[model samples]
Target: MGKIASAHAYANNEVAYLAWDIDGKIEGCLGFEVVRIYLEPDGSVSLRDDGEEDRVPCAAWVGFKGQRNPHWLPQTTSIWPVQKLSWRDLTLRKRRNRAQLRPSEISVRYEIRPLGDWRPGLEPAPDPVPETVAVAKRGADGRPVLDADDRSVKIEAKAYDGKPRPLGYLGPAVATNAIRVTRWIGPFQSTFTNGVLAAQWLRNVIWEDGVKRPNELMGMISDPKNGIRKYLAGDVLPMLRELFEQAGSFLLALYELDDNELVDLLLANKNRIRLILANTGLVEGEWDVRNSHARQALIDANVDIQHRMFNNSTHIGHNKFVVHLDDDDAPVAVFTGSTNWTTTGLAGQTNNAIIIEDRNVAKAFADCWHRMLNDPLDLPTEFDDGMPDNQQGAPFRTSNETPARFTLDNGAKLEVWFSPNMPARRKSSAIPPDLREIYRLMRKAEQAILFLAFYPGQSGKDCIVGEAIEIGRTDQRLIVSGAVSSAQAMPNYVPGRKNDRNDPEDDEEAVSPHTFTEANVSIVRASRLDDRDLLSDFGGEELTAKGGIGAIIHDKVVVIDPLSDDCAVIFGSHNLGFKASYSNDENLVIVRGDKALAAAYAVHVLDVYDHYRFRAIEAELRRQGKKGWSGFLATEDTWLDPYADGAKGALMRYFARG
Candidate 1:
């Protein structure tokens, strides 16, 4: 076996570094997450020891979001060069220059089973045992401890007779030590196809006045098909530079914009630009991974500016949008989505950018962009119409009459949403208007529901759609990846994803496959395109063909029955995760009464699901091993395409036969 790649597993969940040996080779496939990536003096990578300063390239301690992991144990590691995964998207991890290898914290999960329940006979059963568990203080010396350090899970164990105690001793409770479920990840590729790849000027020839009026320009570079040209982020720069020459003023909000070419372009016309970017996640001084130079260059230019834009601790200024104002100060157009203005964000990654020239829409986005520039900490004012249930700042009591939608002549209707709640001054968790639209679409589904989410946060949030699926009980499918969530837990029913369920905090309303099996929702956690998810005969092999372009389920898209009257699509960078709805500065477009668009998105969903479902199947086969799985596949290897019209029926038959 040859070594195709080596990676550094930063933590329990993330793979911070991946080095694909495109020309050369390495050996030994450990088949686990890579814990430490060391840089040698001569520019080679190592997992055993730390490397030199100048030679050491990109590195980060990307840890798990809500996992109980042992800090002392070796982080997960994996080796590649196998005949499986594709090596596309590896370029995105471009030696994050000038950044040091950061350290990460390990989380411990604590479980307090009653002396009677876990270790019965230790003491008589306490009266009215409500199963209340407490957190422990010490580490691995005596017993397991809970990872309560900034973790999302806050367990209120109702088994013992108490409340969720502070991160310490189990006050006057059972004499049982806690149970620790430490999670560690292995080396894997993260598809960051999060970039804006098209130019508005290039898409259309009919433009009234220099700007393309009523322009519905769309750009997504997930892999190019035969005869289709792949557009890169740099392609948009020349267009923007051209616009920069024309527009008198510009407003922008971005997560990161350190790409040298793009930075040079921005700096070239810095005088007229008003930029709002994210606050650095790293501290000041010493190898800065935040790319402070880009911000410094802008500061030096002295244009109207707002640095320290996002607060990852609270809400991210996760807006990759630009609002251009003409000489008269009238907002002309707006471009937005999940892309950062970085090099990897552009050419090396996957992304989408929609440029809408509707004057009202531009105004709304421009308003939000400027509002955040002034107050980066507090949530912006409710910028759009409210939900159907008479939310605090919504224009209507119900979604049916909300005033956020505007339509084009072609019968294509669009609605815009801004985050945090309204009245910018108060604390609000009011769901964004677009999310309510998602709920509406889920509820309206008479036949099917499909979703590709990057984050499906706590069970409560996922349950909003889950509840809809439960009610509809139709052909439901979900492809979740990148991060783990209790509401949408993976790991299979055999083991039951105990690690995900261990946290008591998600107890009240976490939704998962287990919660929705009664509704028959076919839930599958997505793997990188290179994994064994695709059927070899059914173009699973095409994964190698679509290398670098076969992206992760990064598209936060929802597709309802395309032919139905209420057929709808909700997409754009907005994550369905709880944090996305509650805090981050995100946007979602709700297209209602659009049959053609709905059908297109529906087909796209099928294409994505078919590509990954087999990975889930293969995972099962792997668990069963060579005999049973091999026997099943040997006889039934050739099946109809999962994307075929009668796929549901065929799937039912296959499962029934199996």
Candidate 2:
């Protein structure tokens, strides 16, 4: 329709990514208007007695340069269309006041209609189909049709706005694939929090409501029925609640047990929960006090608790996982990722959680929990005195034997490893086994190497970031992109000489000039530009910092060659560094040959990286006294030239071909 070639969509729990392809060159086409049609789970039209099957018009917050307004009133794409071929619909949510339509339970499709020349004050055409009729079975003559199959039945039509001929009349709409807006991927499900404080939606909400502090903001959007809580915790809390309802016992190992809601849930289900609670080290007193209070409650209720009260900072149990066992004591599923069980961990930082429904994976994690419960200190029988950190032995020791390898029911291959398994006295040049496996993948990455991390161990040659940097330097054809929570997490890149990946100097801000210059590597730090330094259109609204957690990017993930058949996703509590492998209690999994899972993770990595890359660059440009380049859109179409050549062109081609 309308020379449109293809339309496709991908969705997670919170957002839908819609893209389209045109048949030929856009000779003089202005833009496109996207309309979303929320459908039933069976892919049937949404029929309602009170209202029409909501044909929601996707829109942009800002208008043209001269047409912009101070109120930030959004203009529907039907009038002011999107200039790009693809858009992310962050506004998708469950229909309000409908308890039956849960998050990730409904499906949606899109229609991409090309827009022509337009003028001011143009309104969309009147509705053609009546509210009483659910389907467009009749033709323009308004006569009922006899033969109406799924392929022949009409569901939508082009929009009109009362202009001449092609002008103000939308082109024929091309239908896109229908997909359930969910986080499930076969036996694996994942969710990510919208916890970036400087995000556009959060900023708009804060500016409009004058809501300050995390609790206030949380209270404003905490209604589970409306699915707004997904903004703070994604599906983590819901998934946990559902797991609690299951007829199973929970094996939970936590570093921080302070979220009141979670504590309440645990107490309610205390009869089936066995917890291994750890200390938060010599840290904040508030966290300690709250944790102690929560722990005492669980203990008072007689919950089976194994307290790993190691007070040292360097060697503490840093695991957050829950393994579910059936009533017969057989493993069913496991929940493990970078997320902690604190409100700040769920609502303050960007984090991820994965639910692996494979029994073997759950069993592996269950084994780790059992080992920790049995031997909290992981002491060696010989009691060696020449430990690396002047300790009796490693705090976690699942690394002595080979990691568990499994073939999932869906043909996905997985290798799981637990930490604190390093030998008491190993060669100085030896690499940690987990880090070694990650390096092997990094060295052999063909298409792209992407990652997101928050201080994944000290930046050095032994870390995954350093390995990616070295590979990107040597192979200019590869696409290597990464984002860390801070600049200090990156290595000090050098031009010709070796990078100082393992510098012992205690410099928080490491200089890496060759990041986007001499090498193909591009490392962006999670940051925001000062409001005063931004364009005048942005005004002087300050960014919000909520909760106690300082880190904004807490996800620890890596996707290698996500578009290829050899895709691998490395994630979990593992920090992708030596410390996590050799000294801390962590779990890392490597999934090979699962392109779907890899692509999902790749989308998330690129999403977070792209969001922060512009902010980092904008801040850097303003600091260098570069004006006009840091803010505002170009007045004319000259901005399109960059997408036809150079770095932008290469990136566009990479994804288009992939």
Candidate 3:
């Protein structure tokens, strides 16, 4: 007989996306129950040290807004089925003490079981199966073991505590393929920060005895602990420290270098580090004023350093990258991304960093570093113009040189490009090739185009935001969603891109800076419900919006057709704008045909988008003196009815199936 259901799991570092589908319709189907099994070192799905099966906990408690008898209670996935077709297990652990599992030390797989026979009023469904299953053989510690060898053993039969059974009833459990989830894929290690300091978790950390402790939060940023930093600065800092322990010389380029911890790191390893620091471009003052501490420290430590002021020029040195060379001075690996070497860049802003261990990628970056070292004042004008040995040129400036494509072991195509493609003295009217390629990808997107930007240039000819808007206006069926921290990144407020225009084909109609709910194109600004909004529904908890920390949506990422084979993700320190392309020293990498990586980025965009969409709407409602978020959950199951039709259902199905 055919299996009743099948499940799939995609994991990256700390989070796993779980999706399941039914083979056929079930009578009185309620939802699906999910259970995660932590395998032993030998791949045995054994009971945990606490004698409890490794079942994932529900992050949210499902309950009615006001009910005399509430069904919501703290429970595992085995007890309360997930109401959605897919769920994300953010807290993947192995033990009862709640210690996070290291990806290398553990292996995990999931089992999905369909739950049916729902009673009216959505009362808890009866126990679908036994609370715990009996193991045929077990050790004194309660973990399953082989009868002879005393080694941890695998259970072939499906049970609540052991391996899944092949045969079962109508709601048979379907197991997903196991995965050793890690942030490191092949020679690449990608890391992102929690960066949302305004989140409730931070509030919990800072609040003690009815007082908010900002100092405690600051301490956490400086010295991350308990995974609270969420690999933001934590992962990058450790990687740098690892390099210092190795026998390698380093090549460093940074825009801002004021973080105390990072400066200490550089100082400790100054003997082997060749540094190129830049001005923040905030003020035209003494070249070394902003980064004086780090620069002065490195200088005192006798490190080989060059400070690039980029003075008198409109462009600022905006690169934040590091390259490592072996003892023989051969390029080994390179770390490059949007993150700057500053406290705010690390712990405050939403940023990303990637460490690529490929020698070819490292060599390419190293060649650019050498070119910059040769000409600290002005970037070289040509790479192969037969210039004298003293006049080396920039490798990434010419179209023939850059948009360099590299193929990874997994068949993902990577294209790297550095900026300042145009001449230094002249302002070109033609669109830069780097940005035109991005616009082309957006226009040709078959399914969806999603992006998150700090400020991808104001709405104009060279603006990536404007290009996305124009594409949305032309093709109403294409899904365009994005989040931006700056208000200028979006257009003026309009009800709808298509409906507001007197003629549907009009090219000059103002696009909405706010959400375009009807046009299949939605853009939201980074905002939250502040003191002005009523929160009585949430136990009178206040959500205060603290400003000036840093950019909340600092990521410069664009995902085109994420679920398709032709998926492309354009991301890096490049602002994805004209100025970044024609002036600033920046890096951009385009990754294509890596569905897993594309989906990771797609989920990140959607996560940030959904978080702020409500806040953006609430802020607008507050502006209009209207009520927002009545602080109530749906009293009836009819709330799910909205997902049966319309754009909502379409979106739900699109992501669920993927």
Candidate 4:
């Protein structure tokens, strides 16, 4: 016999040693065997047979651990016959027959009642096992298992309520065990990268559109309630703050918002006073309160507040107010933006702005500002000047002659002065000596020519002169004119039709030829001077000519020899019309020698003209063709470049015919 194993248990006041071989052979069998039970903290009861120091087959009962008495020993001899059992087989049988056994141990011949589905009446029944064993139950409330792993005899688990719990319980200790599992599963890396890309894209689109809205998709994502709140509040906000602070005066203008939003913004930034001026029509009705509030805030802050009203018909004149600061002899700054100071212009509409730090540019804008503020040409009738009726007709006076003339830090001086009545001189040949100086300068230019006017043909004589100069120039002659028009002049209309011969003569036709008068001859003259082809159909039968009243050319500029190293002429507002040159209180400042400044003025003039022409062609094509010609016309391309492609080429071809 290799090593006999014997189990002894106290039962019926008798001690018996049941002997079995290592191979599970019943070498010898004695009386009752003694089996001692040791309870474990894991809710398991271990059974050890005496006389087996190696504990060759120590077994532990796992399921339903509680105080109970052993049942099998009492009827040990009642079975068919004694049968030996291996240690492995004993453990396996205990696990399989967990429901049939009590939370106790016993030693007996294995053939007794065949453990499967056999209830040992002598032993107390084992309690029912928990359906779901919480390996690590957390919190005092509901059970939430974080994770679980099952391996036939063993299980691992974990749970998280407010805090994490890492502990577990064992089951079927004789063959099965339990363990606690832990892991980390969250998509942090991917989410962070995606969020960064989204933020960048949002910034670009917002800047391009010049609009901002709280309800937009990106705005929602940046809201405090969203999961990305931390990102917006912490990283994004801080980054924007740094960028805005560093931006100084270069920051572009933001689009306007609704009145409610404007109020909210003002409240949020109560320490800072905001100034706004806009056309009333562009704003919502509710903005009146906001505008009033803004004006009051500026007054309280001891800052100057200026409001200029304009109608929708004067879009170019409406938003032309510019601000210049410091350097009385030289303007150091210029402010231009889409913000109209009205509730709607500042908050609702998308606008863009630029602030030029150059002194010359600033001075030019300041001059424009003073002219608009002082000139009574089109101001509201209710304006008060604190002057008596006798002196009301006198020239306006201000504390300063005008905003400071511009002189650059780089030794360049900008001469911006008023030439009252040059337009009148240009429109009508009633030129005084001073007014004639403007025309004389235009005649003196040598290399290049540049003209910026709102309505090119409003001054008939200026049109003729400009056409003559264009024909005379050996170099490029750039003409910039406004395209915004209220005139309903018919296209391709043949003039010269006095009346319809076939129809009966009406009362209008019955009037004498001497009683009839041309409504806008100046406009016609200007058009003819620019495009000589218009003069060809001057007196045809199909012409339908009309005039624009209260139509004003707001721009005042004329640059000659702009690209050359020699001379240039800049004059305007007093158009080439007779009234502008003689009667109107107009002014024009002529710069004779500075080629560099003249070139800059020329460039600016050309830019406005190119934009006007592009928009005009687009609008006209849309109106006349009605065949979706707008799309082709609206495409943007460099006007200064060769006109050999697309609509630009078409435009060049059309002009070339003239």
Candidate 5:
């Protein structure tokens, strides 16, 4: 069957054309330059490139410069948005007495010449398969441990070909081309070669668990135009609802709830949605979770909340996320982070949230979410125990299995790590997949590492994940700064000199631990983060304030060597802590290959580091030669009343003490 194709999509939009040469990416003709086919007033069409008139091949495409198809695959370069053919309408407005391109442009009916007698639609330029290959190996949770260069280099059977030839577009994985792209990925190519296509984005949507308690839900709701409603309800909530309507099915994994408005919104779309909501009884106000208005609203919407309940009936279902599946019943989108669905959480507290649009990543999250529905009875605490028999909830999912690597738009990669933290329940059973991946990634750092965890009591140099980064630091490195807790357990602190692991005679390691405050890593307590005292090296940017959300950097982020080839960042509610590792249901999304992203976060890290490095100097003076993790302000009340604030801080400091 011959397919008649036309470059018609997105009714009433300008059209651009790309003519793919017979050369593959190996020969470096990978990027096809888009050209506009202009219709002269004489009814003669002329090509923008070299004036090719009647005979030209083109594919219809729509989207902004940096955007792409939802799947964003190689096939996406040829995805047809409108089946038959879409129209393009253009109207030029009055220019501000400036430069103009098309003189008072009007809509033009763009025409594309058919290639040969049959047009089999717009066929994407073929990709040449590689001679040798190494893709991500998956673990139980579908995440692979990327190598030091932020990718798992898999060397398969190598075959010698005469030279690079156009093997006729079979999905470019050919030898040297593979090596080149794999080594240093470029835009568009990464999204296709990697499994699921995702346009990588970092949206720092945060709620301040700051100094001033933001106005109540009612107060903010009253002024929908400019208050919390504008940012939270109007903005954030609608995106989720839109996702639900478009998705095939839904999974709700929340730690706490009570945001009546959000619940009501979900209820409004309940019939159109197929949802499985799992809560940890946090909304019941039993443990650390705040109260929410989920139950009644769910009941009103006839939403079934029974079967998937993960209340501490056994394990604390301390996970937070919502997974959406497309009509094909596969995962489409995922939402996760440190937020509990509550009026206060969205409108008041310092929190984080993320929305990822990737079938591969979404599928992984969906798999993890549905596995929780099985609700195993209990997890085996003993390292000696085989797989826990009950399989009650999302158990530790790991192995030396395979890792799934997803490349989104603009040469960016997203590697997801979710958990029951289940991995080796026998030998290295001590570290589950979630924590272990963190350990593996941190261990791969060659140059630098930056961290900013809202809560650090559960993490330290001695902790497994913490030790991975500390123990594996390159022979010489900067004085690490950020969370005060990670600063514990240092070898020795010589004010001006950096650590020298390669020097055979630098055995200052044998010095008495007492005099050296011993911590090579400088500690800066966010609780005491103050701009009045510290000057930022990045700019006079006021990151640290006397009081505000800035007072507490509540984001769990890890930026590894922002300027390196292996640049990457991992963050989410998945705090690199002991508690978050073994018990809490958390998430970590690692983004690689995007320099702009790494640099953006690099500024944040460097800013925090600069601010804290300055603060550490002041803190040491205040410490009066104290030799341990310094005490910091505690999160005593609001969300944690009756929970002795002193005990929590004291215990954390004690655990983190050198």
Candidate 6:
């Protein structure tokens, strides 16, 4: 059927035109540059060149209203104009009249065909072969034969030779073209391809290359921040806390002479056993001896206490309790050295002991303990065993016997030897004879004496300090530094003063100024001014002092002529105080050689000394009503005024006069 078309202008001078092309005649007109086009239902057509559809009317176009018959026809209609004109002429009459026509234009026409023998308003008979329909038939055999409809079939399949062109392997080229076509339809194609898509593709390729597998990749994606929170919260705090605790515990255990604290800790736990002993034949205070009431108390509580005899004639040494572990064959712990298993040693006095947790190290110490425990004849003792039948009257001949030697991991060899034996004499209960030997060695220094201690007390009460001063003033040059006194307030009368005189007459007697008399001794107060320079000029020098917490030179050591023609650093844990040297149970190892350790120790001591000196000076200045003198006192001269104006100066001058 043909359709009528129309175009009309509104009062606002607007017009619209609708076009119809029932067959596929409008396909050629579709292009990328075309702005807008709409197809109508009519068999006719209309055109608008101004690109404004609302200004034109659809009714103004011819044949747009279906002017043709509605019934089915015998043949398809063919509609075409005698001539074709440009779009410009189609809109204006003058332009259309001036346009020339050609035979080619007239030949460009449309054709449509109808079904055969079809009449309008009547049902058509069914054809034996319908267009594009497949017919199924059942024969006697009950099998269906399917045949394709003939009218709708095209010869294009046959037109192409038997060998149809294959899509084939376009490879990356085809993929690239397909991607481009897809990207043209959306604005986000560049972002997806270049960003996430590219990353995902690379990741897959990497996995294919065997660098990583898909499972590992998925695990990484699931939880990337694993263990981070726990590590920050728990592990770090506990590790650091334990480190500091161990450091403090080790230092305390090494220096404290008494085992009360350790004993208490072990006893409190109930599963462990504890024993304490002092070398036999060495006279000790009433509290330190095995028969003392204090020792009996611990024995009553099930703690073992033994005494080993070390007489001049006998070759006996104190037994050391060395703990060993079978698994690692190392020392799990070792309790040895000069510290006594007493309450004072554990709580009040300064002493040295080693607690090695390594099982291998413990085994080595155990070996040493076993060697020391054997019969006097089996081992080559350094001194005479006092047995008449023994060869040379001694366990081992000093000339033939090899000295006890130890080799450290760094390949340094240390030779141990006993000092010459002294005459047997009446023993005193206040101090042990072996300790007196140690004191004699410390006091016999001719040129220099350097002492490092953790707990130093006032002069008279501190036997080591008194002896050190006596020797320092008479023969040896002394340098003493350590943590003296407790966290409590300073004691009255500085330290070593006897309140009761042996004779009241002597106390009343006035002495001449020139006469030499014993007086109380105190540690030299270090000046605040000395702290500013850090004693750098004293580096590698012969004389120095160090004392403070965490100071590297912690071991109570005494070095004589270190790094000078003669050098030695006697170290262990014997505080240069009366209690540590005489009254309290203590231990000290005197090293007559080893210049390198001596020098390092000397330097370390000076560093600590400088620190203590600064603190002392600040304290003295503060006592003198001088606030913030630590900032002002930069030179020794500036410190002199404050020192003289305060009680510290009097004490220092009094000691100097003595």
Runs with alpha carbons beyond 4 Å of true place in candidate 3: 1-9, 18-46, 50-52, 61-63, 67-86, 93-179, 213-216, 223-234, 283-290, 311-313, 378-401, 424-429, 493-518, 532-546
Per-candidate local distance difference test: 0.40, 0.66, 0.63, 0.29, 0.40, 0.28
lDDT of 2 by residue, 289-361 (tens): 4377788899899999887655544665778999999988989999988898877677667788889999999
- Model 5: per-residue Cα lDDT over 1-658, one tens digit each: 2111112211101111111112111121122221223445554554556656632222332322223222111111122121111111111111111212222233223332111111244333333222453333433432344466655434333222122222122122111000010111232111000000000100001111111233333354334343333333212444455555674667777666666766766677676454444443332334223332465567676874533333443334556677777667777777775555655445333344556767777877777665555543432242122222332332344421234568785667787765446542222336555556666756676555566655534324324334533644543343334443232322232223335768756645422121122233433443232223322211112222212322134456676755566777766666665555545556677887666455434444444433344345554554465442222111111212211222212211111111
Each prediction's TM-score versus the true structure? 0.49, 0.79, 0.76, 0.33, 0.47, 0.31
RMSD of each: 23.2, 11.0, 11.7, 36.7, 23.6, 44.6
Best by TM-score: 2
Q: Candidate 3, residues 1-658: lDDT per residue as tens digits?
A: 2233456666655456776554334444444567777877677776867987675534433322332111112234444345555666645521212223444335788877755434444444334332333323434533244545543454333233222112112355777777555667666777665465544334423432233444555555656453444333435566667767778899988888977888988888888889887666434433435576777788789889886666434566788988999989999888887788877677776677778887877887787777677665542242111111221135435532356678977888888777777654233667777787888888899778888888776643466777887898888778888888876666554333554456667545544344434477778787755544644322112122233435678889999987799999888888888778777777788888888777666666766676678677877677667888654334333433433324253443455455
Which clashing pairs does model 3 show?
Answer: 158-164, 158-165
Ordering by lDDT:
2, 3, 1, 5, 4, 6
The worst-scoring run of ten residues by lDDT in candidate 1 lies at: 180-189
Flag the better candidate by lDDT, 2 or 6.
2
Which is superior by lDDT, 2 or 3?
Answer: 2
Pairing residues by index, what is the TM-score of model 1?
A: 0.49
Question: For model 1, how does the per-residue alpha-carbon lDDT over 265-380 read when each residue is reduced to its tens digit?
Answer: 67887887888766434343222245567877777887566653433345455667778788898997776655566544554433434456567767877867755654533322
